[model samples]
Target chain A: SQTIHQWPATLVQPVGSPLSLECTVEGTSNPNLYWYRQAAGRGLQLLFYSVGIGQISSEVPQNLSASRPQDRQFILSSKKLLLSDSGFYLCATSTGTGGGQTEAFFGQGTRLTVV
Target chain B: AQSVTQLDSQVPVFEEAPVELRCNYSSSVSVYLFWYVQYPNQGLQLLLKYLSGSTLVESINGFEAEFNKSQTSFHLRKPSVHISDTAEYFCAVSDDGGFKTIFGAGTRLFVKA
Candidate 1:
């Protein structure tokens, strides 16, 4: 059974501060990782996705960036957070090629509040 | 490119009543459809998915969705929804050969007692 873990379940930061959110998956290797943000009562917006280490794809241009430093470790970072960056950030992982289904498993999510 | 549309933003239904949430998608290529449920303050959970098998896919919680290829729709239906079923439901689509998953605006289901 694979599980995804995200740190700083809830975060409060002042405007223009740096942001770093970490996600790690246990029991799986070489999994595809993704970062998504959801506004209150709104749909999820894909920020970035990584196929492998040092490979990241940006979906929408925003103040955030994502990195896959390790096979099962993904990090979402921001040099200076904006007020619009306040939302629920989710980390998801899917097995590599030859895996059964393409369904993604998500972590508990980090709720960031920028004040 | 693929895009998903969830028709309803909010659906209010009495407990134990039947409910249906509509979803439509536009993709030039064959795509995999999925329905995910998000409880309050929780991450999204996979409810069901339609890949290449039967058109109808069911979850363990009595929710079923049928994929209509011609109509480009995958509508979620539940015979009797419980109060616990109150949550936000999202419809997502991904191309068969692509890794990007496009999600809809989502529909909030409120099952009142």
Candidate 2:
């Protein structure tokens, strides 16, 4: 029962505006997508990862950008927004098939707040 | 290069008592250890994982972790803990073929009754 669907959950945006955060994974398909960021107390912070679809991988470079057009869809973009970019944005997936995906599964996060 | 070292950022314990959350890790290869739980805002759950023939790993709620590959450590215990167990315990590392997963810097279990 793989199911991850992050969304607005909570956002405020404003600093330079422009950021989209959406993650989808209903029952898995070609799973192995991640993008994490949890700053406030600090801890989780990966950035982006995908193993299919358009494929993308960036461990930390700044502005933020991730996309996996379909195949469980995963998107976390930003054209400008910065104020440290706010925090608490997560979306993970990894269950089986190919390296067993590494057993990761998360979602239910997204609390950006940049003003 | 994999690295994880959760040096206890906060722990209050009380409920039924007994609690320990400390992890340490560094890799030059062979890796795969995890313990994640973050209840307070949700997300982050797999409470147990060690990848091979159990060096002691059990989590169905009772929580238990023991994988000391010569003391690279993977501590996380709970002889009796409740109060929902509080939350915010993370300690992960991956390198058995890689998929990138290196995290630590978390440990905030505060179970009080």
lDDT of 2 by residue, A2-102 (tens): 98989989999899889999999998688888898988566998888888999898987889889898999999999989888898898988764445335
**B20 Cα displacement, candidate 2 (Å):** 7.7
* Model 2 C-alpha lDDT per residue in residues B1-113, reported as the tens digit of each score: 67788887899989998888999998876777889999988888888999889699898989999999898998999899999889888998877775767778788898888
- Worst 10-residue lDDT window for candidate 1 chain B reads B93-102
- Off-target runs (Cα >4 Å) in candidate 2 are A1-16, A20-33, A37-49, A56-65, A68-75, A79-86, A90-97, A102-112, B1-17, B20-33, B37-48, B55-87, B90-108, B111-113
- lDDT for B110 in candidate 1 is 98
Docking class of 2: incorrect
Each model's backbone clash number: 0, 0
Clashing residue pairs, backbone N/CA/C < 3 A, model 2:
none
DockQ (C-alpha based) per candidate is 0.49, 0.15
Q: Write the per-residue lDDT of candidate 1 for residues B4-107, one digit (tens) a residue.
A: 98999999999999999999999998788899999988898899998888999999999999999999999999999999999999999878677777789999
Error of 1 at B19 (Å): 0.2
When candidate 1 is compared with the true two-chain complex, its DockQ is 0.49
Cα lDDT, all candidates: 0.90, 0.86
